[model samples]
Target: MNFREFAAKNVHRNVKAYFAYFLSSSISAALLFSFTMIILHPNLGAIDLPEYLIKALNITTVIAYLFLFFFVFYSVSVFLKSRYKEFGILYIIGASKKQIQRMISIENMIISSVSALLGIIAGLVFSKILLAVSGKLLGFNALEFYLPVKAMLITFIAFVIIGIVISIFCSFIIKEDMVLKLLKGTKKPKTEPKTSTILAITCVVLLTTGYYLSVTSSTKTLAGRIIPVTLMVIVATYLLFSQLTIFIIKLLKRNRTLYMKKTSVLWISNLLYRIKDNTRMFFLITITSTVALASIGSVYAYWRDKEAQIDRSFPQAFFFSDIYDNSSMVDEKVNFIEGSLKNEGIKYTKVNDEMKFIIPKGEKDQVVIIKEDTYKKLSSILYLNAANLSENETILAMPLTKHGRKNVVLENIELEVASKLDKGIIPAFYEEVYVVKDEAYEKIKGVKVYFNTINVKDYKNTLNISNNYYNNFPQDNVNKYYNNLLKSGILRATKVAYGVILFSAIFIGLIFFVTTGSFLYNKCYMDIIEDKKKYNQLNKIGLTFKEIKKILNIEIGVLFLFPYIIAVIHYIFAISALKYAFELNIAVPSLQVIFIVLIAQIIYFIIIRKNYLLEIKKSLL
Candidate 1:
């Protein structure tokens, strides 16, 4: 048979072995294609997407493509390694190296062609749905789905290039290795693996340091610490898997009683090889899983907290600000605000506070004094109980205040402190505010500003009505209160933006999880040949099917769960650090993600276990 026929027959015969690689490649291609369509959509640029957001999407698409390349390369290399003996046999039968290379290339091209087609077809089918979901997240009224010609061309070209590269790379694998080595395959063993004392020590030290930094580092220092700590953790995880874990397993084997347990001898005898062989893979899976968890968790957490931020920053629907020194325009500005809200048919309540900006004669820090009655109005509006104030007592309403200290001397007035307000009810003014009796406030000769806070029943509709005011108002530093009120609209827009980002993160994270799971699945299945040979020997020595199953369970269970357990541990600490830094509770969102991932992993384990046991049964038969 010619090379093409040989290649076709080989793929048809071993399709099971190629299935994981094929599916993952198709999925990756589909995702890339879908994203490319969005990027090339004629109307995408016309939408209200921020330039930075557009740029981020573009960058992530490129990153996805790059990730696909490496992922495909790795899968191909592993699959090729499994076929080493087959290729060696062909070489020994007088098939020229050039013909073998051609056969391998043809096989890869066929697989890539099928994968790319499946991926593009999937993308075509889902592109509209994906775009619609994205549009809804972005709060766009409508986004017509259209498959752009350029997108299809780009995707085809990209995957074609990937196919060529894989083919070329696979050719080198055949050329470099000696025929004898290829024939021996994974059975070739020389020196036994020994634990490295230095590496074990380094692993412990590095991991402890990394975990300590991750746990203790707060948000303020997170940026500076995350990079270095991550590098340390990555290195440490590799070393631990490669040396420390193997060392511990060896120690366990040395425990005579435990080592003599049923099936322990069977599984433990070759555990060292499995651990050593898969150390790098385990590290990769753990790190990738952690990244997926952290990214999706962080984005969801931030998205969940967006509303709280908006509420804190824009407490009132609209607030008026004017220099109290020019008390003349205060009423005029208040009238304008009230009339504007009325024009929008917005039902509203108003809280008015008069304040004087002062530098306590000897102190340089500016402070604002308001009447007790005004403080009560502000408090009532904020749903906070009014503070009881006496003529001789003043309450300090500071945004950022010391916890226990309570005295302030303003203009030689020894004002007895009644209480303190952490954040004033009306957040329009951000100065150190003092609430005192009307008589006390009138006595101070200082510039006065009027704060007119408007609370509407439906602020969203009011925002639309007040759009004219926002556009008309020229933003000077003094008129920030008006500007802040306009911020409510921006907040609404930002919520949609964040929603889109959260959706994107979830999708990207899912891809990572699927790819990682596929890698582990493929590796486990590929080892079945060796497993069957070893287990057959045990079966002849009176090992029952149940014992074989138990052995396989322990082996496969460890293979499936080891990376996940480590990943979850890393994820928890990383999230805890984020929580400490941002002072935001991500517990609910984090738990939700954890639950979903856990469920997915359980399902994957069940499927893989079933398939593995079936393969073992077939091998025995």
Candidate 2:
């Protein structure tokens, strides 16, 4: 028989179990495809966003791909382990390991091709949907046909390569083992995780140091050093999950008083057994949960911290009105507010200033004569600066700040000059410690200060005054004054980033929810099925399905909540990441992201509980 026929018949043997992997992988593939296209596509994404943001998205896509790849390989390995006896039987029937390997390869190729095709197609369609959604939020028109052939090709190539490599490696390991060993491997008891007080203390020290460095600004080179520490923490965390989690569960189980008093003991023990096979899945899930929460939390943090930056940018209040005809004058409202402040006995500091004049010192201060020629019109012996000297010649200079700090001479200014400052302003005036004399300022004609900033009582009152004036205007005028100009692009980009993160959270959460619950139920349910006789014996001793299911529901909920706790810890670490990169300060304790995570856990547990209850009731009947 052909591989298709062989797969068609035998694939259903582990239907509920492998189905979880199939669905989870398909969803992951779809997400990965869409994200890869959006990030790497030269023409896609926002033009106005910071270039760093696009680079960050590319990094995120790579991280997601690595996680998905691990889970896919893990799932395949689990399948091989579960069906080792089946492979042994095939060997007994005179099937060569190489022949069996070929069949397995062909079967995997067919399944993967179908799934990737379906997934990429769905991903392409979803890309258009998200594109339109993102475009509308960004205030832009979507391209008529957004899918690119090159993108699909890359995704297909990636999926196929991963499948082939995993399949080949799997078969190699199986070929090394004899049928006897293969069959016996299935019955071997699981080895519990090894943990010690020393290891636990070490983990705590590593995590605490990492988290402390993350939250505080005391650490320098946060940019350069974070990578090494982050990698270290990730390793330590995995080691903890592998060692400490099982230790905790075993300890809880050994406490007979605590264990026998409730059903948590049974669920914890089952979770410990599942952990061996599902370790990678749990780790990936924890990372994704962290990423999902950080994505939304960052944007919310942006808005909360908005007011703080505005204060730094402008420290004034009620300094003006919309008296555009008199743009430079102090408004009557400003005077009135000052009077009110005086009446209240409030000593508000007021500094009115406008002094911006340019002067010429020498050839260095003369911008006009020598440096004016265009590159295309340049002739021989053209010099960048007025002073022509050896290449080794050097000079020093300083720059001025608005705060009036003495200019520190970082470098000397350079310019071409016709002669001494017979005329007024010059280029060197732009450079601080610019040796331009006061006489040059007088010579410079018609150079006027742009605006006088009168520092006032409160910045918000000034903003409020501006808003009230604008609100009084008609609709079209408001767009002309503000919305269509200053803020339109900034809001669009921020909104898209927030939306993408939130959408991914919900999508990935569902994928995890369904996969974890079904995978667990599929494994646990099989044991429950075989134990039908045992459960029947229990029923004979007077335990009802309701009592059993109630216990099961509580047990499953606790079990589902287990990895989620670690996921949340990861989320907490992710929060401080933005502090090192972008200033993210959200007032909310990221409680919303945590809440969404909790909701996902509930959904998964509910699904597991429902399946277990249905089976228990049916078995009782």
User: What is the lDDT of every predicted structure here?
Assistant: 0.76, 0.53
Tell how far residue 618 is off in model 2, in angstroms: 5.0
| Candidate 1 global TM-score | 0.84
Residue 32 Cα positional deviation in candidate 2, in Å, after optimal superposition? 3.6
Candidate 2's C-alpha lDDT?
0.53
Tell me the number of clashing residue pairs for each predicted model.
Answer: 3, 8
lDDT of 1 by residue, 11-58 (tens): 899889988888887887787777778767788777667777777787
Off by over 4 Å in 1: 93-98, 127-129, 141-144, 190-192, 196-219, 319-337, 351-377, 388-452, 469-483
Cα deviation of 467 in candidate 2 (Å)?
Answer: 24
